[model samples]
Target chain A: MTSPSNSSREAIAHIAFDDLVALLEAIFVKAGTAPGVAAILARNCASAERDGSKSHGLFRVPGYLSTLASGWVDGKAEPVVEDVAAAFVRVDARNGFAQPALAAGTPLLLEKVKACGIALLAVRQSHHFGALWPDVEPFARQGFVALSFVNSFACVVPIGGSKPVYGTNPIAFAAPRAGGDPIVFDQAASALANGDVRIAAREGRSLPPGSGVDRTGAPTTDPKAILDGGALLPFGGYKGAALAMMVEILAAALTGGQFSFEVDWSAHPGAETPKTGQLLIVIDPDAGAGRSFVDRVETLVGRIADAGQERLPGDRRYALRRRAAEIGIPIAPALLKELSALAGAPTD
Target chain B: MTSPSNSSREAIAHIAFDDLVALLEAIFVKAGTAPGVAAILARNCASAERDGSKSHGLFRVPGYLSTLASGWVDGKAEPVVEDVAAAFVRVDARNGFAQPALAAGTPLLLEKVKACGIALLAVRQSHHFGALWPDVEPFARQGFVALSFVNSFACVVPIGGSKPVYGTNPIAFAAPRAGGDPIVFDQAASALANGDVRIAAREGRSLPPGSGVDRTGAPTTDPKAILDGGALLPFGGYKGAALAMMVEILAAALTGGQFSFEVDWSAHPGAETPKTGQLLIVIDPDAGAGRSFVDRVETLVGRIADAGQERLPGDRRYALRRRAAEIGIPIAPALLKELSALAGAPTD
Candidate 1:
């Protein structure tokens, strides 16, 4: 097939998955990331791609690495654990990349879930981390429920209003049960994933109908026009818009971070900077409500499964992750080349 | 104007809000909610109407009265505080009506928020309450950020799934800052609120496009068909479905209450009794993040307000409530008569 861009190039590269990881790590190391920060970020990047999330994959790694190189994001900055209570904590990211900040803060959330039943972490001053599913999985693995949301520079409109006043705030929910995998929900409150729209534009494809609107507030199917002047439309109309606002309040208001109409998410040209804020919360099933919570969750999953349903919500991803371990990480040929060059590593 | 089917009765009974409240209180007392419990449940009814949520108003009194008369919901069930930690509590509604149950549980949530910084209350095995906005208002008035979600019996289908698997979950988020009234968000993850569909069906009104489909899996503007054969559509296609599912997973799955597909919401003849669930979260703005949280919130609100044109959510309701309190709760003659007759109180 011909390239979607008018200026087409056939110089697509191929590199191994491990090579890419090494490359990302090298880039982060160059940017002052501590010993293992790059690996974590790379793993997140790979996991996102494997899960079919294209926008949040290796395409974002360079942006992340750039942010680290820029003083805007401290690759080696430690997330300051300022306030800690039974079920709440505040973490100052110290202008760090979100990957490490999130890595250091996730356990605190899980610990709170274990000790006190539920815990909430307000994360301020961090760059955009990869997909949210990977961030919430650790809690789900520990028989706990997890939820997270992030507020980026405003690019979405609030419901009933045409102007952009909020980010396409994303919300993720993970449920833990005694049987079967916990259902994990990760969604951006938009008509389609923002990444999908970007991919469509890059590939010169029309967006799904009603997915976005042009600058004149008229709906359009062209991705480029939608991205240039128009704002992303919220999913399910008002409900999605309201949800985006809820996420803003929870992520920005709760975290004491930049908020709607005040934050910036675009990558700075020739500068490595990130403009987003996030919040994480975890709930232990075995705590407050006791075993009943687990039993009830299991029962809930059972009924849904029993009703002759196809598959549970998070089952496919869990199955895919296990498969990845068996067959090694699945990286596209082009992504493999990028990672190889980043790492200068030998490939099979 | 021509009369709606709702106005079909030429000499419909009029009811005063206070008289109606008294009648509800009496009915609750007779059923078993005891003096204090009865009063709380009655208050919710009046509050719902005051907030202009007529769908959850007097129309529900008779149904609730019947539920109390029946043994399905324990009107006198005395919701007990099962566990309480620093900023979290779990309450067993004991199958009581949610109004009193929520009333009983909210103070605990607020108390925990004061003690531990943030608070969460999971109320399980409760009957349907009114609009979620009123439930959060009390907490919002106290200058705390409050969020709540109620999961009813599953009346909708999971996105991309073949069969029905979730409920018409309603979630509300309210925040209080120094300057403005609380920014209240009371919304359901459905194309149309349940009551609107029901009312439209009763009055023979056509649903808007994309709202629903007929039972044959085909799109239709007929409300009755949508309710009968078709399931209610989620707000943003899949995201709304995920949200409603997420709320159910939290409110019911985490609370150890019946899942949506298991319980019944509508009080249609021959239907099983209603057993619902709710989740409440409260955050103290001044605690960990200091005034910064409030400041950031105010800033965000201000930006939105100044963005060409867009009213802050809940502003209209706050204005209405203020005016109503200053003037009086207006009651239609028919409702006033009904309330007066039921309470044996003379109408003005």
Candidate 2:
């Protein structure tokens, strides 16, 4: 596919998912990542784009490149996977990206899950800068229930607290159903995701009420204020705060990684990724419900629809994924040009 | 303890923790529970009262008795524990109360956690009508991180839905800390717990906004309207609904138990308990962080405090428990007389 005409440069252009992944891989390699690391991250990033997870898709590329350029992360570090126990696998990411670390540990984690009926994978000293749903959805496709948690840089305040102590920690869950795509949900504990806030600021849009507080600790809807000296609030008040605290314990403490509050990257200017931890819990539902697990999930889906929830979580993503596969992932022409330039390809 | 004078009948009385447990045990036995089951449940109920969890304390006795009397639950049923795998344990509760079933499976579950570093317990055909924190707190006390999910009868409407397809499903988590009690939290997915709604109605108080909808599917704050053919809204909008859906999948579908929507007790009127399922996951943090887990927890706790949050999730409960131990579990004289009558003791 040739570049769109100059007259159509403002129009959206489409690229096959594989083509986009290759382009991203080239970009990561150009940015000094190991080929293996580049492959895993490129696929993850492209999948987010294909599935319309806008914040985690191409919008994150600049941050990734800037962080890499800042010497804050080891793009060439190999992950060390340890078989800690019968059902526990640990990965030392060695200051690398979390996606490659998770990819390196997947085989051992799956083996443990197969044998023990459940298993946990803990990756530490890593940066997870992608959508969490992509990390858990494949397990559900393979007939398992998977949950993943990752804590990022502290930007969220605890309920009734003035300072930010917790990250916009996100929890992702995926479970298999009988007839359709897996049921998947990934949500930030904060009122809104950091990326979404950044997008709002770029678009000159105000945030919803109760989204954050200004530097003075007074509630405000200005995304710029929240992004500058202000802080985001946890969703649902105290309950969401509790969930954020739990995520910190599970993703950071239990994994022996840096807490969100411990992440200090000021020395490396332009370092956007937080060096934290990630935890994944995978359960082989077959061991418990046998063949009936997916059937039961299907039943619940039907009832949720009957109860008037027209779109279950991840339904929109699946639809987008299908449309993208049929045609291609839509991308703005300027972004395509920028990606090509980053990958050292001719923009013509 | 002697009965209070008629003049003090409206005044509060105090009972020792052990004394309250014994009294509740006798009442359970009188209500047709096996002595062993009665002992376990009595202690559980008493602990709630001791901890100041009013809704799950002595206030639940009448509901328990009504359900037992209606023959909706098996007070004498023995739970059969199956060592399903290296890290999986399943319990057939035989339509018994969940506490006893959990008790029967605890030993095996602990063994699995010890051997595999993590383990899961799935209980089916069970009725859980008490506080969920008690189910997980013990594991944390034993130096493990534990999480539990339990689904109840349908009373919560999904987002954008008029009818209730999900229960006031509760998720409880407990984790050990270094300098204080284990961090524990038990929260209902609904905006308010069913017991809280009942309490509000009894006190002639209205619920907070966003609590629920009337029978006509219009939002209302009247507790009575929410209790009469109405339904609760999940806390935090669609996010809470997603969590509720996740709980139903984990607690019921994965356990081969009845979903909240499947719980039907019309045949046995006055059946206040929902025969659903429960799921527990226990992780031996030592397998990952070794001895540093608690220290990490302590650090997080300190930061939370420093951030201006005065109290953590379980702080109030622990304070109340300590006070109760210093004095006694407080109860109204009228309620004490009612308990005496239920226990078949002479009331003077």
Candidate 3:
């Protein structure tokens, strides 16, 4: 048997993308999520795993199960889509996951974009615990330029502020190109993502300088300190802080969702998700001034390569995705066993 | 005479905002711009001066005149607006100033936004040499949220690249508030604005570390070197670079204008402006999910204050504008004389 282990020390298990999605779907359904929600989330999480977004992939399964078990998120809640205007679509997630809300509203959002050349999707009362690129990449694949913003629970401090008032808010953008995969990026305004800090704490690793401050408001590199009532700093200081604030406005305030600071989950123990809001803007490049949008994107990509920038934003993900297609997605044996147990499958 | 001299030594002359606009208008007309173009440019420049954006105010007059003299820009070119879709408007600036193009398209853009809940304006073949806040702030005052992006001449490098592939692309956002001035922020993707680097070079001052790299691609603090042949780093490493790239795509590729790296003014020695593109998106907050958009903004503002943030993004500009309104715009006697000479007025 040709084992797919790339590392020398540990033997790894390899599973096809579809199989992984099926397993995750079973796990979610077992955890009481609606079948539709499970399918959407399973695909999203499996795509992340295939693309090497480890932080948002299988690592998030335990959190999702815990939050679902805690009754903090209504996995069976059906999203209510509202056709607000010619270019606006609002979705009430009804405390469900943001992905399902987005999925439910996407058809209407696309119709609006088709009619108006651009459209806005505002999703409120949602829990967004996945990588944001998944929320936008499909639009790019459909030949639309998409930008999305999502605000999470408060874990980041404003500039010159001692208290946490902003989440590790993320901004994601996706645009199509002529010859290759879409250019996509999902970045958090914080110096380090909350998930990354948690991973570091779990691994007994230290964070980079300027990542966060301790509870006493003193800068520290210890990940545990940052997780223990401490707050993350915005990347690039004030500019990043401004982007974070903008995310709050666009996601929470505009969507009629709770602000990052307003997210109070004390009533539900084991809740790991932040019930917040998300905003997505989709634009049709055919309505733009450019003669050929994808051709122009190709030109830019060539220029960037000529400039000696070896990697574009989504290049790594595309590479990993291709590798995953060629050989099944690599997973550790322990993780695979855990996932099998969650799915009620026999583990070898 | 009760001169508005905030400084001890210099005898600063005080002029009302209207007077300053008139002076700038005269100067633009003397420099060969159409009366309409001059009017719009004058108000934009005057507003910058009133709001303490000195780099984009009178300090930009020489560059404008120089570019005009080089015959690199058409000062009198009329903007042509096209209503492309229900929510998309395009403007061909015909190599003229971007302000006039935006002015010409604003009516249709507003109409579309009102009807469609959101609208996009694309301006191509334009020169945007002024501050970006002016482009978005007015929309906020009109009960809309606005976001704008403009890419300039290439002066920033992509990460891991030695060549300059991106400009000091700036993104500006404006939103209405319930009880105060609009919340606005205009920030460049680079570590510092090109104007600030020029100012530092003029003052023989060193820049902060990580600002830019010298000619050989080594990090340096000398603004002169950065101006000479070096390139600026993005604000927050790869994140800022990604934004800069996105701006190029949105403002140039999407708008059918020249990319920053494609800007070639070598034949026009005195040319200073980048004949690029701009993109603006305006949304009607009343069409959003929120009950009251402005009230939501007020809530965020109050929370920010409570979070110990002593100042917001646009607070300083509002304070400066108020002071200017009360005491008139203060200008150095020498600079005032220069402006008067350019306007063909008698200098005392």
Native contacts conserved, per model:
0.43, 0.87, 0.87
Query: How much is the lDDT of residue A158 in candidate 3?
Result: 91
lDDT for A160 in candidate 1 is 49
- Superposed Cα deviation of residue B315, candidate 3 (Å): 0.5
Give chain B TM-scores in order: 0.87, 0.97, 0.97
Docking class for candidate 3: high
Candidate 1 lDDT over residue span A121-178, tens digit each: 8877876657778778767777778888887666676654556777767788887677
Docking class of 2: medium
Q: What lDDT does candidate 2 reach at residue B146?
A: 98
lDDT of 1 at B288: 47
Query: What TM-score, to 2 decimal places, does chain A of model 2 have?
Result: 0.97
Summarize candidate 3's per-residue lDDT along B183-265 as a digit string, tens digits.
Answer: 89999999998888888998999999879987777788999999889999999999999999999999998999889999999
Q: Cα lDDT for residue A38, model 2?
A: 93
Q: Is candidate 1 or candidate 2 better by TM-score?
A: 2
TM-score of each: 0.89, 0.98, 0.98
Worst 10 residues of 2 chain A by lDDT: A1-10
Q: How close to the true structure is residue B166 of candidate 1, measured as C-alpha lDDT?
A: 69
- Quick one: ranking by TM-score, best first? 2, 3, 1
Leading candidate by DockQ: 3
lDDT by residue (B18-78, candidate 2, tens digit) is: 9999999999999999999999999999999999898999989999999999999999999
